[model samples]
Target: MSTLEIRDLHVAVEDKEILRGVNLTVNSGQTHAIMGPNGSGKSTLAYAIAGHPKYTVTGGRVLLDGVDLLELSVDERARAGLFLAMQYPVEVPGVSVSNFLRSAVTAVRGEAPKLREFAKDLKNGMDALSIDPAFAQRNLNEGFSGGEKKRHEILQMELLNPKIAVLDETDSGLDVDALRVVSEGINRFRATGDTGVLLITHYTRILRYVKPDFVHVFAGGRIVEAGGPELADKLEAEGYEQYTKASA
Candidate 1:
């Protein structure tokens, strides 16, 4: 089975450290949820692992199935089966959704998918996510609702089928109905048993629909608490007050 290991990861942005020696491991077929207060460095961990230029890894290593991921560029990481669903998806003015997805698949797979084959796959993914077929021709994330943008992110995950997926605050702006749809897509992805998911969120709403195999509490830039699903329930009841206090 594939594995994504984070060994004492340290990330800094603009000469200021955010993630402080964080360590976690996600195995294929497992879903690990990261919940924390704002500014606790949860997103920093995601961006660092995804190789974002803004977040610099000052020390430690990120390995994917034994390969040094911290050594790879962002696109190389994607090709190496690492996917990150950003908290804020950017708008592409001219790139159509279908074209963008096809190009992404081409990039990851190292070759273009045939028109007929790719068309069928696209249709299935969109239909499953309840997206309108006509929107495929629209510009990516341009004038789309928050829920629509998040669904598009999940759509990419479905098509790319990465070995490891890090979703950063995907449930942030979604309403109840939208939350259910996105959660279902996450469940579908988890069912594949070949992709490990590191889901980051501020609350436990999404966890109700997609149960995490493990729940981690992030505070003061590192994970201070880790446990089974019960930990989520505990966090929901008690909040991060204790952890934040302890970390401080």
Candidate 2:
């Protein structure tokens, strides 16, 4: 179990400020939801935590279990047990999903999984998510449908089992059926009760499947409001309009 702490974070992309003095924390076994309209910097925070070069941290510190995260490179951060499930996962043309995951597991764990044992874990993860094993042989996220892409993200989350998982708009393009599958995968990630989750989304539908311990409303690059589960209900009923007006 690990703790992800963001304190007074200020992030900018290409000299344009995105996140302004944002502060949030996700402790082990907890889930925090960041909800905001488009362009509110939710994804910016995600990228910054993953140490994406494009989003520069103009101020503040990101601590993974009290260790400085901003100092490490992207790969080093992943190796330190921080995983970001991108809203749009990249398509690697020549790499199969299995091979990609295998390399990732090896990189993060610092050792390769035994061939037979690794195969068993892969099969179990896919079966748990109802993904066909054949999909493993296909290129990473190439030619995959929207649901498949999201499922592939979940597959990575399962295989990696990072101490903290940051999922950015994972439910964006999924239908109801796909939503169920993706939601189930999220629930599975919580089975260990030690993997923290920072789920960023615009809609409350996904929250119906996975309850959040804290709900935060982001507007204009800062967290404006935060509350318990009912905060999601209020947002659903009254909409971000109220929060937007208030924040304005």
Candidate 3:
């Protein structure tokens, strides 16, 4: 099975440290949820893994199935089977969603998908996400609502089929119905048994739907507590008060 290992990962943005010696592991077919208060470095871990230039890796190693991810560039990391669904998807006003997705697929696959097959796959993914067919012609995430952007992210995940998906607050801004739709799409992706998921969120609501195999409480830029799914239930009821207080 594919494996993503984070070893004492330390990340900083603009000379200020964010992720401080965080360590975790996710195996294919396993879903790990990271819950924490705002600015607790949950998203920082996601960006650092995706090789975001803004987040400097002060120290530590991120290995994906024995390859040192820190040695690869952002696009190279994508080709190496890493994907990140941003918390706030940016708008590309001139690039159509269809074109953008196709380009990304080509980059990751190292070959262009057959046009007919690509179209079919795109349509199927969109249909599964309940996205309108007309969205294909629209610029990527341009003029889309929060829920639509989030669904589009899942749609990309479905089509790209990365080995590891680092979803940063994907459930944010999604209404109940949208949350269900998005969660279902994630579930479908996980069913493939070849992809690992790192779900980062503040609330446990999404955990109810996605059902993480492991739950981690991120505080002070590191995991302070970890347990099974029941940990999520406890967090939902008690909140991050204890963890945050301890960190403080």
Candidate 4:
């Protein structure tokens, strides 16, 4: 069975319909890229799946490994092996990165990890992201640069090791080097387990580093096209204009 499935999903924010109806399935050990122009509801899908209170599910269901995710609370969903890395991660002042990640790790594992082991793992994750070990001591995402915030998100993904992770605009503000680092971190997370990935982005830069197993084009709040890797290449060459016009 697919690790994550969105069946006829519908969502809205403040009664303004965003995701009209969407469907996608992600199996283990595969990466699926959702590409589209701005305002195509790509971010809305991610937020709705993650149970953002602002984005209400108006219809359909989201399943994780055949379990109805809609029945679970936000934290329950995370504990059930679902993770969403936001396009704009919030900054938590007064919360050290180490403390925040440790808490998350504890919550996901249902027990506190040994301090030594947790520290070691944190250091390793930071190293993988090319982040300095000192970063763990700073406030979570507070005062962090755009690239740093993205890297921090990947770090949490590595430490949590969720079954399916939805990365929203993960490469939005990254430089070449930082993009490579973030991509490597994602690859490493998948390597640890047969993690399924749903990557949402408007650009194709990160796709070059992390090859996608499937590509879905989003337009007008729905998936207009689904294909193999070549779909991404086609989008890069011809742009989303053709798809947008066709969908319109």
Q: How accurate is candidate 1 locally (lDDT)?
A: 0.95
TM-score for candidate 3: 0.99
lDDT of 4 by residue, 1-248 (tens): 24798999999899998898899989889999999999999999998999989998999999898899999999999999999998999998899998899899999999999999998998888888888888889988988899999999999999998999999999998999999999999888777658899999999999999999999999989999999999999999999998778777
lDDT scores of the candidates, listed in order: 0.95, 0.92, 0.95, 0.92
**After superposition, which runs of candidate 1 have C-alpha atoms over 4 Å from their true positions?**
none
lDDT of 2 by residue, 144-207 (tens): 8888899889988988889999999999999999999999999989878989999999999999
lDDT tens readout by residue for model 1, 171-217: 99999999999999999999998889999999999999999999999
lDDT, candidate 4, at 216:
96
Checking candidate 4 for backbone clashes, the offending pairs are: none
> In model 2, what lDDT does residue 220 have?
88
- Between prediction 1 and prediction 2, the one with superior TM-score is 1
Q: Relative to the unseen true structure, what is the C-alpha lDDT of residue 20 in candidate 1, on a scale of 0 to 100? A: 92
Clashes of each: 0, 0, 0, 0
